[model samples]
Target: MAVAQKLQRCAVSQTGKHSASVIFLHGSGDTGQGLRAWVRDVLKQDLAFAHIRVIYPTAPPRPYTPMRGALSHVWFDRYKISADCSEHLESIDSMCTQLGTVMQEEVRAGVPKNRMIVGGFSMGGAMALHLACRYHPEVAGVFALSSFLNKDSVVYQAVQDRKGQPLPELFQCHGMADELVFHQWGEETGVQLRHAGMDASFRSIPGLNHQLSRMELEELRSWILKKLPLESSAQGQ
Candidate 1:
């Protein structure tokens, strides 16, 4: 299949000099504009994010199996979760290739691989996890919200073949009450990452659903701040 053009993106940047870039992908049926608003609201009150440039890329409209073949903005076609919780590997490689183009643009624009963070929600988060592990392994961190990994997928096999490379720091969160992506799957994703030698941390939000909660957002904020500090500080500088 031919590689798709870069997806339309919505962006936000701090006023001062930026030291890092964060690319966040939205879930199915959502646009980058929607994620931009959500991320802006989540980080607006915090000054620690003042030196980061945030990018939200819209996924292409395609047939989604979870929606019963309805066309929606999705990184890849998601089939039914198997009994072993492994996702179908079809289209994952192509999708990651497209996402890698976006990362390449960021690198060409002067941001180092180690100064970039990649993350997303739901299916978007699944893409982020795959990209970080297989394609952009040198990134600063990876965040997967209400998402899981397919250990049997091609990406996992590729990562397993690479030797002596450091894995990125990972912070994953899932709601105990999440009906869409079960909490157990998220826990398994964390275990897989750790077993692959990643510095992975998984957070479970009690009584929360698939949707974002204030407490979950706060926890994510803390994790991001801890992982990527303000550039104004000496340590960060």
Candidate 2:
């Protein structure tokens, strides 16, 4: 028997068949219910996806072995990202397992792989993208907001492991004024994604800071609507 992953998540939905599900994986220090506020504030306006579900997965407050046993519920073990991200391969492997498990559960929640999207901020963004590389059962989209791939990694291994297939639609949104993670880093990773022949849209939000803004959330909602199930769109509208 496989040990079920220990994670906390908050799910929001109104009523409808729901075309797609947007899973927001929060950063290390945040809780799953955190994004719930964002959804209620922004997504609730549409009324289209009254049944659209947004699932937020929370990282625990435990010690992160990725940082040499440091105390933090991180997606993967940290290894001084700027220098080299490949060194943390082992930790990334563990993180991938938990992520895959979470994804599996979501699929069973009525949203199949193709009708799903994965996204997050900072550490959460990196992990969301990592899952995108290995996306199976298919995925509608991926978003990495104000974050970068492990320092200088093309993520070739994970890409190759996807049976020589390609990644799903992906968007890499950066904040020009983000001081936490250099805007250039996100740009570079976007380049890498494009180089890999994936449909990646890299947008740097001018005058924005580290956190995702209301306008950004609206953009996400719009993107989802354009691609979400037509039935869902009709119901939402």
Candidate 3:
């Protein structure tokens, strides 16, 4: 069975007219409410966010393999921290199925699949990449902050199956000084993704560690605005 949790919504659209949506997942051990509080502050700083509906979905506490089966709020379970390590496919697929439902709900709620973006931090970012690159290619874009993929990820195989078809745009940002998820892993993921015909861009943040920065968030905001601009009808209102 898929693990589930109540998602938290932050309606940034001040005019009550949303034209786009961003579903952002939080890192391992963090809850949706925690990330929503932080991102809400940064997003509100930009007027463009006023038309975007942000969804933060919490991962239910599960037995994390890396932590010796200790419970953690992670999108999936992995045997280790290395990007080259073996993947826990069962857990990963279950989470993807759950996220797919979330996307479908957004579509049913009036947001087109092409106007939605999936992104996250750390483990959450990895899940975002898995969903956008493998499961939900129809999303507008995907951004991974301080995250990476397994060296032999199923995402690569899924892309190969497309036979040169295009997937959603991808923006990956990593801290050069990150010790947990190395910058090299993020760069390699981007390179492999491009090799597989994905529209992927990677940004290297010098002197950054395993966390996010204001500059990184600003860059992400710019990318989001470019990917999902306000519709003509909404702009004229």
Candidate 4:
């Protein structure tokens, strides 16, 4: 495998002093710019996000195991796409390290781990779950759209290894009609997370598909605001 490209990041600068941050990873084969556009066109419609800095990170081009080793922009390589498939830990560990470094940089730049939320779509969401739960539990929150985890995900092991440490809250949303990643798998992921003692919440969207829906984004907005609210100083009071 050729050396993967360096991770790239595109950001939506906050209108006010950046009090909180949201690091959203794009799905496989997608770039940071694409997710950045989606955030600006859709999520930015809500004025409450004016003070929030949204960072969209792009994965480096690497050989994806599922696609006959074809190069794709993915956080990690996977042999299969099902929740029960075996995880590719070698690549997963590397990606987790990169993501961890990103969050640490955010902390040094002013946003504490407690004021940052990490999330993503599809494969990206899986990475978000790994980053928040396995790598950095101090994050404020996590959200995954149409995502899942393997039956023996290291996330479960990491949580169990912690032995009662507080974890970041997680919000998950899945479309009822999702075909690419089954809705049932998303539910199971939630169940497994909860069983592992994670503070996880799962939402089901009816008549939807593998893609995102406006309703889901609205719910995410509400969840984010609740998790990372502005303090008096950051609110420009």
Candidate 5:
């Protein structure tokens, strides 16, 4: 018997025939609907994304250790903020499985693995990075906004093992003034990825906070266009 599809709570948008897909995971304490609305507004002014399918998946609400065991939708359990940010391997692995399922569904629906982009904000972005590093079926790109990576040697080893697979182009945007994730952590994450032989681009936005800014979104749009160029016929249509 085929396994039942346990689809994560998500909000989806597909304008025309879906030639490409972008999965955007929401941050902790945020809903898929909220991220979907934000993405919709961002795409409204840019018609180039009309043919791209965007999905915002909500993380399952669970007890967060960093928040004193308060329940929230987080990608993984909070880890110590040391030089090597330790994470719960089990939690990270579970979320990666969940995200992989979502990606597989898109592939079954006719989208190619290379044409799909995976990204997220804050905690969600961190998970995206983790997922991309450890999983198979390379994606087109990965966007990590105001996020960091699991500095554990195990995580690095997983990435090293995937050296044979084509690494996805990574676009990391972080606010220099971010208090939650810390700007330093973002910078170090980029460096670490590069040292591991991944093509990672880290953009530092000065004076911004832990949240996404308009400038960051604009940069994201540009990055998307570079990865998945809009068809000429679709231009100005």
Candidate 6:
């Protein structure tokens, strides 16, 4: 069996009025509850966040791809650290199974697939991107920050399993100064995603590193609200 932790969400419906859900799969080493804190401070402050629930899945230890000098948790192990070749096949398989379990748990809690959005930071973002690109029937959406795609040798097999499905809209952001995952990975990931027929909106924030900014959070909040069945009138003050 796999280890899993539930995201202690901030916005719980008192009478169960949760209209939508955003699942946050955090990067390795970060607590699963970090996403909830992020929402309370940043996303929740936005007008749009009032109508939805955000799910943050906490990953349990053991059996991630090799990362030298870093003992953090990871969705998969992409050791290439460069564009040469980092296969994501193994990571993809593991993540799909774990994520499916998490999604099922949410559905049981009254969250539906169409209304759920998944996202992560750094390595967690990589996992989020992978799920959206490969999972059939798509999902509500995906948001990836400071992450890249895992190159798999058997990618064709994965795609074949998908049967040429259209992917969901992806919102990705990266800091040009990220010391760990190079910023170029973000651009390349966007290019690859678009080539694979995904609607990817990529952004690069100069002088920022790793952490999400107030500005970026606003943009993400806006974009998410637009995608969900939120009230459009909430836009523009």
Off by over 4 Å in 6: 1-16, 38-48, 63-71, 151-164, 231-237
Error of 4 at 226 (Å): 0.7
Q: How accurate is candidate 2 locally (lDDT)?
A: 0.70
lDDT of 5 by residue, 152-225 (tens): 64546666666767888889999988885578878888888888777889999999988877788888978887
Candidate lDDT (C-alpha), each: 0.77, 0.70, 0.84, 0.85, 0.77, 0.67
State TM-scores per candidate: 0.87, 0.83, 0.91, 0.92, 0.87, 0.78
Question: Residue by residue across 1-237, what tens digits does model 4's lDDT show?
Answer: 565445689787777788788998888899988876765576555324756788888898989988999999998998887677789988888898888878877888898999999999988899999988888888999999989888889898887777578798889999999895478888999998888888889999999888777788888888988998877787663
Where in model 3 is the C-alpha error above 4 Å? 1-14, 40-48
Residue-level error in angstroms, candidate 5, position 206: 1.0
Error of 2 at 153 (Å): 2.5
RMSD of 3: 2.3
lDDT of 2 at 190: 79
Give the TM-score (vs. native) of candidate 2.
0.83
Q: Flag the better candidate by lDDT, 2 or 6.
A: 2
lDDT of 6 by residue, 1-237 (tens): 657454233333322256677777777677566655765576555223565766666665545445554545556666555556857566567766777777787689776778778888877777776665566345778888887764443432444455566556789888888886578867787776666566778999999887777777777878887877654453332
Q: What is the lDDT of residue 161 in candidate 2?
A: 53
Model 3 C-alpha lDDT per residue in residues 74-112, reported as the tens digit of each score = 999988889878888888888888888888887898899
Please report, as a residue range, the 10-residue window in candidate 6 with the lowest summed lDDT.
Answer: 7-16
Cα RMSDs, all models:
2.9, 3.4, 2.3, 2.2, 3.2, 4.4
Report how far residue 128 has shifted in candidate 3, in Å: 0.6
After aligning candidate 3 to the native by TM-score, how far in Å is the CA of 200 from where it should be? 0.7
